[model samples]
Target: MTGRRALRAVQAASGLGGLVALGAASQVWLRVAVPRDRPLPDAALALSGRTVAPLVTALAVAGLAGLVGLFATRGWGRVVLGGLLAIIGAALIAAAVPHAWAPGPAAVDDLLTRPLAGRDPTRAAVATTVPGWPLLAAGGGAVLVAAGLATVARGRRWPGMSSRFEVAGQRAGPPRAAPDGPPADAAVWDALDRGDDPTL
Candidate 1:
């Protein structure tokens, strides 16, 4: 694809990646058990998940910024930015693995042992598994990385925002109508070019 199209695709992918990461960070990531089976389960935030939510959010924000910058940048700048995006994707992959970082049955035991005032620890099943947000985030990161690669490959040929939005080149409507006169008389500048002056 053309550089301009590649850049557009990258922008779209990066935005999508940011949105996905935001969802994971803002929502519950896990559910822990209680003393006995209860009507509701204990939910855990992304901050308390296997991977830190802030890190994921930060990567996502960077990815989004990269899209904005991609439109403005070319040459090696795009390559460097793309490499950063790749690193973010790698970090996401790493974060999703190595389940040891996640809290296991102990988290449930604590809640069952002592619930806060006005709260009761209902009998819930022990939760030894982590939620799915990390995986989702990782998938988004992967897509973002692909977009970054596209930028690196073809960004130099892409047009800058300023060039596309230039006032001299931009048109908001149909072409302007010519003056109601003969061609030689209508465009005095053209007539002057042919050794004739309209005023003289």
Candidate 2:
């Protein structure tokens, strides 16, 4: 593909990746069972990806907002933003991969303990990971990294916003004479006055 098309693709991919990460963050990543004393049933709780890794959501938001930066900036400015986007993607991957493999105690402690504050503190809760969501989040991060890398490598050659406006002006050719009341000579004079090539 041309550099312009490639840059557009990168923009699309980056936006999609951010959306995927946001969706993944809202999904359930873990299920924990809160045990109580005898004769009481264990309380089951669901922990979302946001609870497991807050950084995932934060990074996703930043990545989405960076799309505008990619479009508005150019040259070294774009390169710097691309590098920053890559770093955000890498951080998201690091934050989510661990939860995809296994649940960490520190990961669940904060959100899990909030609801069980008044209950039995000695009871052990079994935390089961639903890896689907975390895996999805990691995949999103991978996409963001790819988009950012592509931007850093080839963004300088892509057409800028001014180029698009110039292209539009060229495609417009010359203005046409009004069909109604202005005589042909009058129209020619108007074109000449405006420095437009009337013959064309």
**Candidate whose lDDT is highest:** 2
TM-score for candidate 2, please give it: 0.77
Q: Summarize candidate 2's per-residue lDDT along 22-95 as a digit string, tens digits.
A: 89999998898777765677788888888878899999998898788888888888888888888888888898
Residue 105 lDDT in candidate 1: 52
Per-candidate TM-scores read: 0.60, 0.77
Candidate 1 deviant stretches above 4 angstroms: 34-52, 97-102, 105-130, 163-200
Error of 1 at 13 (Å): 1.0
Single out the weakest 10-residue window by summed lDDT for candidate 1.
43-52
* Poorly placed runs, candidate 2 (over 4 Å): 104-107, 115-118, 163-200
Q: Note the Cα lDDT for every prediction shown.
A: 0.61, 0.81
Candidate 2 contains a number of clashing pairs equal to 0
- Report the CA-based lDDT of candidate 1 relative to the real structure: 0.61
Name the 10 consecutive residues with the lowest summed lDDT in model 2: 163-172
